[model samples]
Target: MSHVRVAIPKKGFERFEKYNPENLKSFEQLIEEQNGDTYCLKLNMHLLRMYNAYPQLVNLKITRLILLKALSKLPYQHFNFARKYLIWSQLIDDGIRVIIDMADLLENEDYEEFWMHYKQKATILPILDGFDEAIRKYICFKVGSTRTTVPCMEFKMKLAVDKEVLMKYITQLGWMINGNEVKVFPLMLNDSNDRDVIRGIICSDIR
Candidate 1:
């Protein structure tokens, strides 16, 4: 009599055990060395596959690291790299897709919409340490470099922060809060070309 071989799928917890400390250490090393490298793109995809299959098995620390790296490249990469990686991995759902959507809004300078979306995804905040701060810094830099002064109300809306919280960032930036306006920089009553030059100078200071 011929017998047919049957395969049994491993239990979820059993699969989870396979991602031991040793494996995690090795994975972290690879991520550290290949950050921003093209080869790392494939490595990220592999991670996404595991996350999609058994999110409970994959560590949130690892997920946060990869997602933050992707976010850091925004506006510059325009999230094309992130989109491609997610598409190839077929894991563009849930928090992952939400982050990419946020990146899109930031790239387009749609601050109000981005904040609204961010609030809706507050549940994902635990895995996104420093995300709001990073975005706020980016927006502050953009606004500071481009404009000498911005209305406090408008600035607060752009940052999605209350007046008190906005004051903290303004103080840290060495900007003055005058009446209803935040002075981002000294008034440069110059032509557009001169303003562009001043903007370049201000941007260089951050770099």
Candidate 2:
């Protein structure tokens, strides 16, 4: 096999040999073979995760530079996922930042937009899901209310549906309709409140 250049772009790749000890050519072995290159080592997303930089990979014929190129043109870093390994945050760069920017759609509560844009990146959907769930569930956000000065369009939308009766069912109302995800603004739900978020919690307890 030929020597692979190890360049550390903004992509999430670290040379952790244990991740893929299965590979015959270890990082040490590769380093011994290479003559000289400023780029120490490089791996694509899957290769990185397989080597334990993160937790997983996508089964596609993708390349490190290609992923980095795509990520380089992106605008942000860090994304939400359902089952992610946050321990490997050190593998950050413009490329990974771009990949994380994809999570901005979920954070901004633009499901339609999110799906529309990154649905194709679904090859890495599992990884994306990990980050998405991690981000949305942990980040604190409050439901919108007329009494509060902060803008909460999700809450306001509930108010618009039926100002008087909406509050009556605010906690249980189905104000959002993006695909099959009926719950609206679930990330901001606080179980104590009598609004959209709390209703689901109370209903589950009753059942």
lDDT of each: 0.61, 0.35
lDDT of 2 by residue, 4-68 (tens): 54443353334463355444234434433332232222322234344343334322222222232
Model 1 CA deviation exceeding 4 Å by range: 1-25, 28-65, 72-80, 88-91, 124-126, 186-207
Candidate 2, TM-score vs. the true structure?
0.25
Worst-scoring 10-residue span by lDDT in model 2? 74-83
Error of 1 at 117 (Å): 0.6
> Could you tell me every candidate's TM-score relative to the true structure?
0.56, 0.25
Best candidate (score: TM-score): 1
Residue 79 local lDDT, model 2? 20
Q: What is the lDDT of residue 31 in candidate 1?
A: 59
Estimate the Cα RMSD of every predicted model relative to the unseen true structure. 13.8, 16.8
